[model samples]
Target: MAPVTSGSTRTRSTASHPGHPDLAAYRARELGRVRFRRALTLLVMTLLMPGSAQLVMGRKQVGRLAVRVWLACVGSALLLAAVGWLWPEVLFRLAADTTVLAVLRTGLTVLAIGWTLLLIDAWRLGDPLRLRQKQRLAMVGLNGTVVFAVAGSLLFASHLVAVQRDFITTMFGDGVASAAEHGRYNVLLIGGDAGDGRWGLRTDSMTVASIDEETGRTILFGLPRNMTNFPFPEGSELAAEFPDGYDCETCTLNSLATWAADHRDLFKGSETPGIDATIEGIEGITGLKINYYTLVNMEGFKSLVTAMGGLTLNVRDRIPIGVPVVDYIEPGVRRLNGFQTLWFARSRESADDYSRMARQKCVMSAMLQQLSPQTVLTKFEALADASTHLIETDLPASEVGEFTQLALRAKSQKVGTVSFVPPAINTSDPDIDKIRTMIDDAITKSEQPSGSGRKKGPGFSKSSSGASTGGSIGSLSSGYAANQSADLSKVC
Candidate 1:
């Protein structure tokens, strides 16, 4: 056959081709290949261009893929447009939301890297579509696997960053809290029933969560709202270092909040009794040192669930919800929205307050469990928005990430939960020596380094007909169910 001359296209030479007579034929063949490749590249680009897949891939009769992409783009645009039109805060929030921006930035980086690799392959192969049907199938599978892996990794990293940032910003804005003295650390986890709009709502739920780094064990001591003690920490002897302005001598432990609210001015400034004084009062009452306190005032609870795509709860009993008893729930495990879960944890009318407290712990566990990379990616904007207004923590922002990482790592470990409810103590029991002893014993066990995945502690007896069971609080190790009961009522 006669050698064909080079057509209109330009061709690059390899190291071996210097002055071959068939260079014209080679150039022509190369031009034809270039034309085919350019056509194929355009076809691939169009196939992935969100609306031309059917036409480019000769699947006009089966345009589902193209239709799907078009629908996705359309849906996304409509959703964004609706958000921009109706709830414009979503848009404004995305703009100001640092967490959202960080996620977007990381995602774009990954996409850029993948596109770069694709371009390099096209340059070397000279014909991206040169693969036979079998090879193309294999390439598709391989490329898909790699793309998913990279996307998943980037997504997980972005989520961690956002969660940590939200936790940090909510806790320690810019101020630093001086760490307390040695062997005296206080951590408070406050559960509020804010959604119900109850007037003068005392802490709906309270747990003095303490961690002894030396022993590497965590202790969560439940505190009833009604335990009689000084209202604010600074007012008691424990708060002697701080100013003592309010007097809660006759008030119950729960009513201390009321008294503190009444004497708000006395606790506002740094020199005055603020959180420090409150912590002092708790220490004096429980005889347990408190070094840190975390208060989630109603709003935080709602925002957190909303950020977490809501939560799932094991409904202990059928309960009516909403005003006028419009909504009802059957007893079983079920998922709940932010408002529903908040109400479930805070409800005291349907069941005994003790049961409500248990539900509160369940809500907390479920909330933490639901958090993952996908959830964070979807709700990053919502979380970023909620973080600014909902939470209040004393921990430094930088440390918040570390704390969350710790919690995430410990996700598989069992968490022990105990409430400070004993029939031995009642409204009439002014001397809570037995209750205090139980708390102290439990704290000691929790502080001990866990061995064999078991915490050492005393057994608890259940009170029969309001009589003290006289049993010591029970001990638990990691991986125990949240509802696991060890009858601590035996003693009194």
Candidate 2:
């Protein structure tokens, strides 16, 4: 109603509202809020899809390059893993390369740095001043944690790979492995003792682990230390030396090491003359070609078992540790420590060597079942260190990958065993023909799938009359029930 006057004029500031903040100030506040939201969105995007933030926001060109590199990294990793599983030779060769290891260390470092920077940059693009102080700190803490976890995981994995590679390289070196014979890889396992008062490197235990390459089903041919008249493979150096089998009355199956050590000249150009000669003798006994040999130190065997966290054995009877300390591992489902386990597998005072052999087989089965991947990873360093002193093998580093794959496969199936001792055959004068027949039949039956008329549930075939059946083995007191079955776990 009052007339407008210049002195007392009423002025409108913005179209939206009068007497409010200036347009510029309001615009600034809105921009701040929008930027904070963008920053939040950018972080979430980067976390979900690496490089996506740069792809959609900051720099299109950089985002595209980052995306491509990320894809390549993923693809290459998957390919390497697949190859490692299929043909471990590739992995073995790569592991042997110092240059590759350096590259891996450097690449992981670069990725860790670059990844962290990108994540931090994504948060920076979010424009933190717009966010509350608490929100900004929270983001910083979360991103820091993520960076540490990712980087640490990559670095640790790299270190483990290197350690395992070094162990394989140092242990196996460059020895060439023999080809699989008749679709099988037969490795000679020898337990050697060279402590004080003992003859030089006398082999106390011998077992042939013959694995089928395809199915991974195994047949363990146990040769007694007292076995005599076992013929050597024809044309082999040992055979040429001992024309009528290794028939020294005092020097039987376990005496090969001392003899070979004494006559290294006979085994010319042999790195491990003792082990090689012993292998030839085993080949003769089992009628199977020996692919490789593993010599385990008996004294150090305790440390090896301890490193594996001990073994669980179904003790059939009271077993003595030995002379000075007459410690007996009592019966029932029990866990045995290093000292106790060694005696359980090797002691022969109360019982003869034949009984010791069966107990050893059960010990082997327990070790095979318990050495899982988790156990290896957790005790990786200990196991590797133990092996350096405890085991000596002719297995090649290059072929380790293949055998590793085979071993992994073997873990899932039933293990078949044929101990050529006692009631099954006469050890003092074993029928060489019958020994060969037993091994051949075991292998043949193993090749057939489970429940096939030829192969029952981890036991000898009902059809094969001469086969080492569980029923026939009952002639003994404890009964050779535990060791002579295809399924050692069930009997043990």
Candidate 3:
């Protein structure tokens, strides 16, 4: 079969010879027209974008696209700048620096580079459609990034303050010191059954420890809860000043709770049973002006201990029998979980609150020791978690940091622990005056001038003449006994 030329080919053969110059010229013109139209579109689109510099007349499509991209870039840049200015933290945390300013600068740099590249791409592409697509994608990504940054910044700002506040609460807790002596800190470490249904509320154990970091000395005085004396300050005028409902009288400070419980009329106006008056009474008893006071209900203690991990304690003697619900703690060093520690603190069947108070002090001392840098680093994550849940205080976070720094600087510093128990200072009968004297002496001794050492000395020391022999533990009834014999090394 012969290969046939189509009818159009035959007509072309007739009209013009195969090597015609005019036909070649016509084909070149058509291709040129198409390219020109595309370039024009690019130019027009470029003009639509911000900054007409990219939209040259020749390449309409490419120029127009370049203009559109430039506009998008400019818009995104402005938005990012505003975000950085308004919510620096958005950039800060993403950049992850303690310094806020540094993070913002870094975010701005990233935004500028990213937008500049998008603008360049729009100019290179001659097709308006392609340019528009790229610009839209860039805009979406940029806007989304800024939105996430803003949200993150807000959350970061909120958490920053919260974390610091939590740290401060752990340090200066309860803000007991007055502004005049703001530098002076006092911890009224109390051991008590706080109105649990099983037992009425009363301060079972009280130890007023004064910390004069300025002088580098701490005075710890143990006050028996059962002592009978001028409970509501010593003077009659001061007693009269209290709420009339309390029925002002000289009685055992420990009895304040029992009395208040019996006479609910006294606490009618108050939500927190006579705490204010009780604080006043405490200051009067010790004659040491109190600046801050904190009342911790039972729940707070257990949570706090658990957060710090189980506390470490040196068991002085065999727990003998277990307090119901809580197990028997064997004699020796024991790592106690939160529930165990609380049970150990509250167990009065085998020992009185006086002994309990000593145990609490021992636990506190152990806690301080465990809070060292070595311990902190070992369980930093847990410590941080526990800290947030278990504390309330007025001291600022910065101050807490300062204290931590101070503590860390003196790595070799010694923390002395004492419990005022049997044989240290006897309280056979409710001798309020005698107890007061002992507390005063302990505070005075702690604050007394010392050499390189800043810790509290031995709780009780015999004078040169030596006093009369003290009575045996069996003879003492309802008398105060403390674990004054201290092995000071365990404390921080």
Candidate 4:
């Protein structure tokens, strides 16, 4: 061997002997750099493959299990995304299902905890204590940042799921589901207030939103609150009492709720006697089977508008603020706040009930058009809170997912409206048979293909010859544009 020694071998052996101070220092520096690179590589592997770091430098069994779980989770997510893209209803169903929400919440919480632990283990495998001071600090910083960021996001998602579940459970009831009648769902919408000296909440404004079961085309049948001599369903309690029609001076449609509340015995086993009685009245008038009823508290509704960041309305005229006219909401296309909107929808100091009804319809149209899914998601918590206080309904929670889908569909279509006010049908003595026929005709027309024998209303024309009756775009006798328009948006 001594005879066969080459120049290169002799130089390497001299360097290995550590007799040369500079050579030994160079070797130490190279070794440190190699260790640093190895530690950095393990951290990168942990980030990219979750358990690959453990497989190479830590427990092999743990690494295999972690990698398998990570793969399964990723695969399941991709599958769900694909399915959701193909059929969006499935996603809505999952979102609405309480059991699904609970499972999701639990899974998110578990993933947060599990992923944090895995990251900690990966950091430990990197052996940061053996790393140089700067490298160790860098690894610690990176691990902590990644752990908190991922865990925080998961935890936040879980919290949102929990909030939605609670909102659904608390807001909706376990009421019996009502089937759609004549291929349409007639939901009675009542807007009113429960003030002092009132027997119950007054049915100030009432409209039956008859929506097509399949197409979601809706026709709003605005029944005047002062409608008198209206017969109820023949077999109902109110019908028996008002067999000759509610023909007294105080026996108007709006007064029916108070009348029913005063005599609760008439509505036995009913939670909302006023609303149920009002629904019967509406059914008796429109001849449409009521599927459900949503009673909105006028006072609390202001909060909902505020939550939506106010509603943009075309205020045609100056609307008085208070009953005695304290302030005025200036005209033009303006974004009105909650207070102004409530006043715009409810104030009748100088306006007739019909004009107010027209404004309300405009408000509804604006809300439908402007309240996008993105807006709802962004302002969900605020909207949810306001809704709980604003609305009361017999709509079952089981049907929420379906109704949500219908609403989305409704948003895409034009809303047809029919109001049974003066000149068309006298509120004091409305012709029941004629009103029913008109409703049936409207529904039939709405179900037809767009632009097929359907007349569009004069939408928001400022230069029209029509008189501006109480800030609305038409005279009471001629009919407010919003009240009887094919597209309410035109008038608004």
Candidate 5:
């Protein structure tokens, strides 16, 4: 039984066939080519349709297990997609839970590992010796790429989840909340200068943001720091201390915190006596109940603005970088750094406090308008770090999710403002009833069905000569009248 070695010796073999070289050599080469093709086909099948390669490779048990797991993962993903689409809050709640996030991160890591191993095994089964040099190199490169891409993406996602959890724990803590008042949440925003030394812990900037619980429409009421003769909340610790209203000489609105701090014994059992007393004054004047307060340190406040990559302001005048350095901020549309921005918001020595309040409101409106979700997420770490140091709040951790949802809704709507400064309604002798009526009317206007879109902030105007007339924000003019307009963007 001698084997035939040549085409002439082999039966029915064509000698001049283009498809045939030497009979035995050509047949062996053809088998090698077939093996290479099969290896590629199996690799592609496993990549796209997991477990298919194993089934074809006769690893029935491994194939069945892989197939079942793959099917379950797909089913779970589809179910989540459906729930997320229909009821997004369920997803939000689940995401907010640290335990859920931890499990998700762990599961992703494990899946990445398992998938990478399966892919490597599939590449080994491809039998690289039978492949051409180029084909073998391609297989190795492709396998390495898939492994890194999957594992790297999973690891990055897990890091983000961890960052968010850490942020939640540190910033929100375990604060106890006061009930939401009048179907709304009113948070007092205080920009305080603790280092000024003139009046201890003076809250130079104060604004009450009254947010509608359902609609998310917000009304910002600005109270001047120079405001005097305002009543305190009746029967509260502050009222008992300053019975005849806060009307002492040099007892400006900003000084209330210092007074409360100095006489903290009078506030008995209050943790942040200064803040609590300040809230009383604000509530009494606006006639809007204050639910919580966040005192932003003026020094650290610059870091926060920097973190947002600075805000754009249509600067109308040559604002001075007052105190310590007497340089001027020659104005146009300027992107200001932290120090320049703080001065722009708080500087009144150049003009007056009343005028600066309008500028502050403009800055506030700009933040609400420009601080989009995409921007925040991109600069997340910087913003998160800056915020933790800058903001001192009584807002509870549990309500953080609810407020976040509300804020997201608010972003799509125009922010309305009422500045109770100067000749509008004298803060020195403000009519409480009138203030309440103003707040009520603003709320009504904001709740209108045909909601007005955001108006451009006191836009720059030009004189007949085409020279810039400039707006009132950075100018010394009668500041924005309280309840003057439903949209502060227009009045800035």
Candidate 6:
């Protein structure tokens, strides 16, 4: 064969030989390309289907277990979403339950850890040691990024869940539940201040919020601080002390708190004697059985408003910031900070107590209307912290979920109000019969359908003869618009 071999035949033989340098180089290049493709495929599979990479790369048992768990988690999430959409109250109840929250937090933590380990295993299955330097570096970067992102999100969610649990446990207590009376819940709201030398808090503002149990329709019965000669419930300790009524010259409605505090023996074993006594007096005056009481600390209220990022109010007149008029909140529709709002609600400079009460009503309306869900989520932590200090209540923690749902329902409807001020009733000696009649009528009207003979309140009507007082739309003599309006939003 060597004697007469053709040149073309010789060349072909050389190319086919395993020992040839050119052939060896070409095979090496092909092998490198295959390894790179394999590495890329494994990473992509792990990203799309968490355990797929391990299944294909020889960890069948681990891969099967992970895939099954992932499917179960997805299915459970879909199921929960479906149930929540159908029954919103169920979700609220679950959210308010401490045990459920603790379970959720633990589940989230476990999920985060499990997901991270799976991602790391997927990277290991890619065989980084055999990959080219550039390919190995790229895979490591991508894998780390995904692991941190997923794990970080889950951990953050767990933290928020823990925060909510803590807030609920700390702020609310295991108080006895009070049943609704006559298809309604009458809650007493007291705005109090404990200044120097005060025996206890003096209630500057008081309102009985009578709400429909089913509809959440509300009517606010505002009691003046200067009101006198109001009766207490027949069987209450206060009534035994003053059989006729609280008729002494200095025995105004506001003084009851101090008196109750000084003589706590009357309210034996009671943590809040002042509030208990006030509730009894309110029940007799309004002829409604009070279900619960919420006392708001005036100083702590500033912190709450600040946490909410201030409130927008219609400033009808210039309000002095402090006594002797150091500074003034000028009139106009304006956004007021916590300090300014406190002054707006509390200031009585050049303004009577009735005028101050009117301003307080406006502030309450503005807070309710402006507090949106988005704001709550954004400032949830601050709001929770402030609320614990701001409010003291006998409302049961178990009822929080229900009341929360009710409050949301109330936001959509008009709020009716009836204040016992000036021309309506004499503060020195209020007509108990007339006051009760007004409260009954207001509640009856509020319970009616929106347009079914439901009369609207006298809202923001200028006094034809009297002038505006204390930055309110109406005068004390004519009745402040915000104090007795059917729709508080319209007047405020």
Best by lDDT: 4
lDDT of 1 by residue, 151-243 (tens): 556566556566645544554655464453344345777554454542234555677765544332344566666565333343454355234
Which 10-residue window in model 6 sums to the lowest lDDT? 457-466
Q: Ten consecutive residues with minimal summed lDDT in candidate 1? A: 467-476
lDDT, candidate 3, residue 45? 42
Residues 1-492 of candidate 5 have per-residue lDDT tens digits of 986587555545574455666666777778877877877787777767677788889888888888787788889889999987997667666666666777877877777677777777788788987777877787778878876886687677677777677666777757676777878889999988747462227888898999989878888888888888878888877777678878878878888888888898887888787887788888877777888887888878789889989877767777767675488767667777888878877776556766677777777777776677787788878888888877877776677767777776776677778777656677677767777887888888887874465433322122211122222432224444322446555544
RMSD of each: 14.7, 6.4, 14.0, 5.0, 5.4, 5.1
> Which lDDT tens digits does candidate 2 get at residues 1-492?
986666324334243464456766777677766666777788877766668898787578777777777788889899999998897757756765555766786677777667777787787777676676766777778777877786677777677767776677678867676899999999988888748744336889899999988766777788888888778888988889889877776758888877888898998887777888788888888778888888888878888889988877667667777775477787656777888888888877666666677778877877876777688889888888899878888888767767776776677778877888878778778898998998888888888778522222222112222212212223354447544776665655
User: In candidate 3, what are the lDDT values of residues 120-180, reduced to their tens digit?
Assistant: 4433453433334445454446444644554455445445434433444444443232542
Deviation in angstroms for 100 in model 3? 12
Answer with 3 or 5, whichever has the higher lDDT: 5
Per-model TM-score versus the true fold: 0.57, 0.79, 0.52, 0.89, 0.82, 0.87
Q: Each prediction's Cα lDDT score?
A: 0.51, 0.74, 0.49, 0.83, 0.73, 0.81
Span of 10 residues, lowest total lDDT, candidate 2 = 453-462
Model 4 regions more than 4 Å off: 1-49, 194-200, 451-467
- How good is model 3 by TM-score? 0.52
For model 2, the superposed segments whose C-alpha errors exceed 4 Å read 1-41, 77-109, 123-133, 194-200, 302-308, 337-340, 377-382, 452-479
Candidate 1 local distance difference test against the native: 0.51
**In model 3, what lDDT does residue 358 have?**
54
Ranking of candidates on lDDT, top first: 4, 6, 2, 5, 1, 3
The TM-score of predicted model 1 comes to 0.57
lDDT at residue 360 of model 5 (Cα atoms): 76
Residue 18, model 5, lDDT: 50
Model 5: CA > 4 A from native: 1-77, 129-133, 176-178, 194-200, 267-270, 325-330, 334-340, 451-477, 481-484
